[model samples]
Target: MEKKNALTAFAALSQPTRLDVFRLLVQVGEAGMSAGEIAAALDVRQNTLSANLSVLLHAGLVRNLREGRSIRYFADTEGLRGLLGYLLRDCCGGRPEICDPLIEDIACHARPTPLDKIGQYPTPEDHT
Candidate 1:
Protein backbone atom coordinates (compact mmCIF):
# COMPACT_ATOMS: atom_id res chain seq x y z
CA MET A 1 0.00 0.00 0.00
CA GLU A 2 1.07 3.53 -0.59
CA LYS A 3 1.90 5.72 2.37
CA LYS A 4 -1.29 7.76 2.01
CA ASN A 5 -3.46 4.70 1.76
CA ALA A 6 -1.85 3.16 4.83
CA LEU A 7 -2.39 6.41 6.70
CA THR A 8 -6.07 6.42 5.78
CA ALA A 9 -6.47 2.84 6.95
CA PHE A 10 -4.69 3.61 10.19
CA ALA A 11 -6.86 6.66 10.74
CA ALA A 12 -10.02 4.65 10.16
CA LEU A 13 -8.95 1.98 12.62
CA SER A 14 -7.97 4.65 15.12
CA GLN A 15 -11.65 4.84 15.99
CA PRO A 16 -12.84 2.22 18.48
CA THR A 17 -16.05 1.30 16.70
CA ARG A 18 -14.45 0.92 13.28
CA LEU A 19 -11.62 -1.13 14.76
CA ASP A 20 -14.09 -3.43 16.45
CA VAL A 21 -16.13 -3.77 13.30
CA PHE A 22 -13.09 -4.69 11.23
CA ARG A 23 -11.91 -7.26 13.77
CA LEU A 24 -15.35 -8.86 13.88
CA LEU A 25 -15.51 -9.10 10.12
CA VAL A 26 -12.04 -10.63 9.97
CA GLN A 27 -13.04 -13.19 12.56
CA VAL A 28 -16.03 -14.25 10.47
CA GLY A 29 -13.86 -14.64 7.35
CA GLU A 30 -15.63 -15.19 4.00
CA ALA A 31 -19.01 -15.57 5.67
CA GLY A 32 -19.63 -11.90 6.12
CA MET A 33 -22.28 -10.34 8.32
CA SER A 34 -25.09 -7.99 7.39
CA ALA A 35 -25.28 -4.49 8.79
CA GLY A 36 -28.02 -5.49 11.19
CA GLU A 37 -25.95 -8.40 12.43
CA ILE A 38 -22.93 -6.19 13.03
CA ALA A 39 -24.99 -3.63 14.87
CA ALA A 40 -26.46 -6.27 17.11
CA ALA A 41 -23.12 -7.93 17.78
CA LEU A 42 -21.48 -4.67 18.73
CA ASP A 43 -24.57 -3.36 20.50
CA VAL A 44 -24.29 -0.22 18.44
CA ARG A 45 -27.10 1.81 17.02
CA GLN A 46 -27.68 1.32 13.31
CA ASN A 47 -26.93 4.91 12.43
CA THR A 48 -23.70 4.92 14.40
CA LEU A 49 -22.61 1.62 12.95
CA SER A 50 -23.42 2.80 9.47
CA ALA A 51 -21.09 5.76 9.84
CA ASN A 52 -18.25 3.59 11.12
CA LEU A 53 -18.73 1.06 8.36
CA SER A 54 -18.63 3.81 5.79
CA VAL A 55 -15.34 5.05 7.17
CA LEU A 56 -13.83 1.56 7.04
CA LEU A 57 -15.08 1.05 3.50
CA HIS A 58 -13.53 4.28 2.32
CA ALA A 59 -10.26 3.42 4.00
CA GLY A 60 -10.07 0.14 2.07
CA LEU A 61 -10.05 -1.89 5.25
CA VAL A 62 -13.53 -3.31 4.72
CA ARG A 63 -15.76 -4.20 1.81
CA ASN A 64 -19.50 -4.75 1.47
CA LEU A 65 -21.82 -6.52 -0.93
CA ARG A 66 -25.52 -5.99 -1.44
CA GLU A 67 -27.51 -8.86 -0.01
CA GLY A 68 -31.15 -8.37 -0.93
CA ARG A 69 -32.18 -5.21 0.93
CA SER A 70 -29.24 -5.42 3.32
CA ILE A 71 -25.46 -5.16 2.90
CA ARG A 72 -22.99 -7.80 4.07
CA TYR A 73 -19.61 -6.57 5.14
CA PHE A 74 -16.19 -8.29 5.13
CA ALA A 75 -12.64 -7.45 5.86
CA ASP A 76 -10.75 -6.65 2.64
CA THR A 77 -7.95 -9.19 2.80
CA GLU A 78 -6.03 -7.75 -0.15
CA GLY A 79 -6.02 -4.32 1.42
CA LEU A 80 -4.88 -5.82 4.69
CA ARG A 81 -2.08 -7.69 2.94
CA GLY A 82 -1.00 -4.52 1.23
CA LEU A 83 -0.78 -2.64 4.50
CA LEU A 84 1.05 -5.50 6.21
CA GLY A 85 3.46 -5.81 3.31
CA TYR A 86 4.18 -2.11 3.41
CA LEU A 87 5.04 -2.33 7.06
CA LEU A 88 7.38 -5.27 6.55
CA ARG A 89 8.91 -4.11 3.31
CA ASP A 90 12.04 -3.06 5.11
CA CYS A 91 11.77 -5.33 8.09
CA CYS A 92 14.85 -6.21 10.12
CA GLY A 93 17.04 -4.11 7.83
CA GLY A 94 17.71 -7.13 5.60
CA ARG A 95 18.42 -9.46 8.53
CA PRO A 96 15.55 -11.86 7.78
CA GLU A 97 16.32 -14.15 10.72
CA ILE A 98 15.41 -11.36 13.10
CA CYS A 99 11.93 -11.07 11.51
CA ASP A 100 11.41 -14.82 11.05
CA PRO A 101 9.47 -15.35 14.26
CA LEU A 102 7.20 -12.37 13.68
CA ILE A 103 6.52 -13.45 10.10
CA GLU A 104 5.78 -16.99 11.24
CA ASP A 105 3.30 -15.75 13.82
CA ILE A 106 1.41 -13.76 11.23
CA ALA A 107 1.53 -16.51 8.61
CA CYS A 108 0.15 -19.08 11.02
CA HIS A 109 -3.06 -17.10 11.26
CA ALA A 110 -3.20 -16.60 7.50
CA ARG A 111 -3.59 -20.30 6.82
CA PRO A 112 -6.84 -22.11 7.55
CA THR A 113 -6.70 -25.40 9.42
CA PRO A 114 -8.81 -28.55 9.05
CA LEU A 115 -11.28 -27.30 11.66
CA ASP A 116 -11.91 -24.27 9.51
CA LYS A 117 -13.44 -26.49 6.84
CA ILE A 118 -16.12 -27.53 9.31
CA GLY A 119 -16.52 -24.02 10.61
CA GLN A 120 -15.28 -25.04 14.02
CA TYR A 121 -12.10 -24.85 16.04
CA PRO A 122 -10.14 -27.74 17.48
CA THR A 123 -10.86 -28.60 21.09
CA PRO A 124 -8.31 -29.95 23.57
CA GLU A 125 -9.35 -33.53 22.76
CA ASP A 126 -8.83 -32.91 19.04
CA HIS A 127 -5.25 -31.82 19.67
CA THR A 128 -4.40 -34.92 21.64
Candidate 2:
Protein backbone atom coordinates (compact mmCIF):
# COMPACT_ATOMS: atom_id res chain seq x y z
CA MET A 1 0.00 0.00 0.00
CA GLU A 2 1.08 3.55 -0.58
CA LYS A 3 1.81 5.81 2.37
CA LYS A 4 -1.34 7.86 1.86
CA ASN A 5 -3.53 4.78 1.65
CA ALA A 6 -2.05 3.38 4.84
CA LEU A 7 -2.60 6.68 6.58
CA THR A 8 -6.24 6.71 5.55
CA ALA A 9 -6.74 3.19 6.83
CA PHE A 10 -5.09 4.05 10.13
CA ALA A 11 -7.21 7.14 10.48
CA ALA A 12 -10.38 5.18 9.82
CA LEU A 13 -9.46 2.60 12.43
CA SER A 14 -8.56 5.29 14.95
CA GLN A 15 -12.25 5.78 15.63
CA PRO A 16 -13.77 3.47 18.25
CA THR A 17 -16.86 2.45 16.29
CA ARG A 18 -14.97 1.87 13.06
CA LEU A 19 -12.31 -0.11 14.90
CA ASP A 20 -14.96 -2.30 16.51
CA VAL A 21 -16.67 -2.79 13.15
CA PHE A 22 -13.46 -3.79 11.43
CA ARG A 23 -12.48 -6.22 14.21
CA LEU A 24 -15.92 -7.76 14.18
CA LEU A 25 -15.86 -8.21 10.41
CA VAL A 26 -12.42 -9.80 10.61
CA GLN A 27 -13.65 -12.21 13.24
CA VAL A 28 -16.60 -13.19 11.05
CA GLY A 29 -14.37 -13.77 8.02
CA GLU A 30 -15.84 -14.37 4.57
CA ALA A 31 -19.33 -15.09 5.84
CA GLY A 32 -19.69 -11.36 6.41
CA MET A 33 -22.69 -9.67 8.05
CA SER A 34 -25.55 -7.52 7.00
CA ALA A 35 -25.76 -3.92 8.16
CA GLY A 36 -28.56 -4.74 10.55
CA GLU A 37 -26.55 -7.62 11.98
CA ILE A 38 -23.49 -5.43 12.42
CA ALA A 39 -25.49 -2.65 14.04
CA ALA A 40 -27.02 -5.10 16.48
CA ALA A 41 -23.68 -6.68 17.27
CA LEU A 42 -22.03 -3.35 17.97
CA ASP A 43 -25.06 -1.73 19.57
CA VAL A 44 -24.70 1.14 17.17
CA ARG A 45 -27.52 3.03 15.53
CA GLN A 46 -28.09 2.21 11.87
CA ASN A 47 -27.37 5.76 10.76
CA THR A 48 -24.19 5.95 12.84
CA LEU A 49 -23.02 2.56 11.61
CA SER A 50 -23.68 3.58 8.05
CA ALA A 51 -21.34 6.52 8.35
CA ASN A 52 -18.64 4.42 9.96
CA LEU A 53 -18.97 1.72 7.34
CA SER A 54 -18.61 4.28 4.59
CA VAL A 55 -15.38 5.54 6.15
CA LEU A 56 -13.96 2.05 6.38
CA LEU A 57 -14.95 1.41 2.76
CA HIS A 58 -13.22 4.54 1.57
CA ALA A 59 -10.09 3.58 3.47
CA GLY A 60 -10.08 0.18 1.73
CA LEU A 61 -10.33 -1.62 5.06
CA VAL A 62 -13.78 -3.01 4.48
CA ARG A 63 -16.00 -4.05 1.59
CA ASN A 64 -19.71 -4.61 1.13
CA LEU A 65 -22.00 -6.52 -1.14
CA ARG A 66 -25.56 -5.80 -2.06
CA GLU A 67 -27.77 -8.66 -0.98
CA GLY A 68 -31.15 -7.73 -2.37
CA ARG A 69 -32.38 -5.02 0.00
CA SER A 70 -29.58 -5.22 2.56
CA ILE A 71 -25.83 -4.88 2.30
CA ARG A 72 -23.38 -7.38 3.77
CA TYR A 73 -20.03 -6.10 4.94
CA PHE A 74 -16.69 -7.85 5.21
CA ALA A 75 -13.10 -7.02 6.00
CA ASP A 76 -11.24 -6.41 2.77
CA THR A 77 -8.48 -8.97 3.15
CA GLU A 78 -6.53 -7.73 0.16
CA GLY A 79 -6.51 -4.21 1.52
CA LEU A 80 -5.55 -5.55 4.93
CA ARG A 81 -2.66 -7.50 3.38
CA GLY A 82 -1.44 -4.41 1.62
CA LEU A 83 -1.48 -2.38 4.81
CA LEU A 84 0.28 -5.14 6.76
CA GLY A 85 2.85 -5.57 4.00
CA TYR A 86 3.58 -1.88 3.96
CA LEU A 87 4.21 -1.91 7.71
CA LEU A 88 6.46 -4.98 7.55
CA ARG A 89 8.25 -3.98 4.34
CA ASP A 90 11.26 -2.80 6.34
CA CYS A 91 10.58 -4.84 9.44
CA CYS A 92 13.25 -5.08 12.13
CA GLY A 93 15.95 -3.70 9.85
CA GLY A 94 18.21 -6.63 8.95
CA ARG A 95 17.37 -8.75 11.97
CA PRO A 96 14.75 -11.15 10.56
CA GLU A 97 14.47 -13.03 13.84
CA ILE A 98 13.25 -9.93 15.59
CA CYS A 99 9.95 -10.04 13.67
CA ASP A 100 9.60 -13.81 13.56
CA PRO A 101 7.48 -14.21 16.66
CA LEU A 102 5.14 -11.40 15.71
CA ILE A 103 4.69 -12.85 12.24
CA GLU A 104 4.11 -16.32 13.61
CA ASP A 105 1.50 -15.07 16.01
CA ILE A 106 -0.52 -13.46 13.23
CA ALA A 107 -0.04 -16.14 10.59
CA CYS A 108 -2.58 -18.91 10.28
CA HIS A 109 -1.38 -22.52 10.64
CA ALA A 110 -4.42 -24.50 9.57
CA ARG A 111 -5.36 -25.57 6.08
CA PRO A 112 -8.30 -23.78 4.49
CA THR A 113 -11.69 -25.38 4.67
CA PRO A 114 -14.27 -25.33 1.88
CA LEU A 115 -16.40 -22.85 3.78
CA ASP A 116 -13.51 -20.46 4.41
CA LYS A 117 -10.97 -20.46 1.61
CA ILE A 118 -9.39 -17.13 2.41
CA GLY A 119 -6.85 -18.40 4.95
CA GLN A 120 -8.99 -17.48 7.94
CA TYR A 121 -8.01 -19.59 10.93
CA PRO A 122 -10.42 -22.45 11.38
CA THR A 123 -12.72 -22.28 14.37
CA PRO A 124 -13.05 -25.39 16.57
CA GLU A 125 -16.52 -25.97 15.22
CA ASP A 126 -15.07 -26.40 11.74
CA HIS A 127 -13.68 -29.78 12.77
CA THR A 128 -17.06 -31.19 13.63
Which residue pairs in candidate 2 have backbone atoms (N, alpha carbon, C) closer than 3 angstroms, thus clashing? none
| Per-residue C-alpha lDDT of model 1 across residues 86-117, encoded as one tens digit per residue | 87898898999999988787664554474555
List the candidate 2 regions with Cα displacement exceeding 4 Å: 109-128
Cα lDDT tens digits, model 2, 24-121, are: 99988888888899999999999999999989998988887777778888888888999999888988988989999998988877755746545553
Model 2 has an lDDT value of 0.85
lDDT of each: 0.82, 0.85
* Model 1, TM vs. native: 0.82
Query: Distance (Å) between predicted and true CA of 34, model 1?
Result: 0.4
Worst ten-residue run, lDDT, model 2?
119-128
